[model samples]
Target: EPEVTQTPSHQVTQMGQEVILRCVPISNHLYFYWYRQILGQKVEFLVSFYNNEISEKSEIFDDQFSVERPDGSNFTLKIRSTKLEDSAMYFCAGKNGQRSTDTQYFGPGTRLTVL
Candidate 1:
């Protein structure tokens, strides 16, 4: 069985500082995504990447945010500037194929704390 993994499991930063969250998905997966969940809130989709390009994105993924697959194995999300409201659990997810029944595996998540 394969799963997603993230680095820097927890991050604490001052408001306005930058942060980069990283993840590695299953090697054979064809789709990758980034999501966030504010404390006690619903999981929100931030962006989805395929073929090294953004396939989908939500309003939450504004100019201040960006994502990159710097290499074949690593996917990264960067926030140019952090805000108190940006504090949340960021998850990396992936799916092997685009099927309604395909399972989307999720990483444990990186907890970002903005102070």
Candidate 2:
């Protein structure tokens, strides 16, 4: 079974700076997504991509945040400007359409610390 993976397990950025988080979803998966968990908060859905387009996205994924697949193997989330409140553990996930069972695999997560 293939698994999702995120780069730079941990990232530290300054407020008002730009940051890009990268993820590689399961090669066979049809849907790719991103989620974030703020300290002491529940995991929140950020965005989902399918067929090279955005399938869905939450309010948290505002104009400041963008998602793209620059290449066939990489899905990326970019924050144009960082904020202190943006500090969180970002997790990348992928789900394949399995008639028997729908399973979403997650990456270890990239911890973003903004100061």
Candidate 3:
């Protein structure tokens, strides 16, 4: 079965550094989303993209964050000038978008540590 996955299972970076988190979501999925979970906090939606365009974004996804489908197959998230508060597990999720009840699948997530 196809599944979503992220690269650099773990990453460590200094504050103000730039980081590009990559996600390889199920190719057949029509809708893709990005979420983050701070160490002890619950998951929060960051952004959603479809048809290679950003459909929605949460307040958490500020000017420093960007999402793209550079190759029409890979989903990528980039955080510029990463801040200490940016440290967290970033996840890539997707759904068929064919029905409201469609199950959303999520990747194991990439652990990002900003010091």
Candidate 4:
């Protein structure tokens, strides 16, 4: 079965540098999303994209953040300026266009740690 994959399972970065988290969503899926989980918080949706444009986005997706499908198989999230509060598990997910009951398959996640 195809699955979402993320790179650099764990990353430690400075408080003001930039970081790019990579993901390869399941092939054939049409909806992709990015979510984040703070150490003890529930998963929070950051953004969702389809047809090469953003479908929906939450307040968490601010000016410092951006996402793109750089190629047919790769989707990437870039953070222009990291902050200490940015430490969290960044999850990449995909849905098979089943809107009625879409189940998102999530990657293991890239733990971003800013200090």
- Per-residue lDDT tens digits for candidate 1, residues 8-110, read 8999999999999999999999899999999999999999999999999999999999999988999999999999999999999999898879989999999
Count of clashes, each model: 0, 0, 0, 0
31-109 in candidate 3: lDDT tens per residue? 9999999999999999989888899999999999999989977899999999999999999999988577988899999
Q: Indicate which candidate wins on TM-score.
A: 1
TM per model? Answer: 0.97, 0.94, 0.96, 0.96
Cα miss at 108, model 3 (Å)?
0.8
For residues 1-115, what per-residue lDDT tens digits would candidate 4 score against the true structure?
A: 7879999899999998999999999998889999999999999999999988888999989999999997878999999999999999999999887576989899999999999
Query: Relative to the unseen true structure, what is the Cα RMSD of model 3?
Result: 0.8
Q: Which sections of candidate 4 miss by over 4 Å?
A: none
The predictions' CA RMSDs to the true structure, in order, are 0.7, 1.5, 0.8, 0.9
Runs in model 1 deviating more than 4 A are none
Residue pairs clashing, model 2? none
Task: Report RMSD for candidate 2.
Answer: 1.5
**On residues 5-71, what C-alpha lDDT tens digit does candidate 2 reach at each position?**
8998999999999999999988888788899999999999999988899989998999999999888
Q: Model 4: which ten-residue window has the lowest total lDDT?
A: 95-104
Instruction: Enumerate residue pairs that collide in model 3.
Output: none
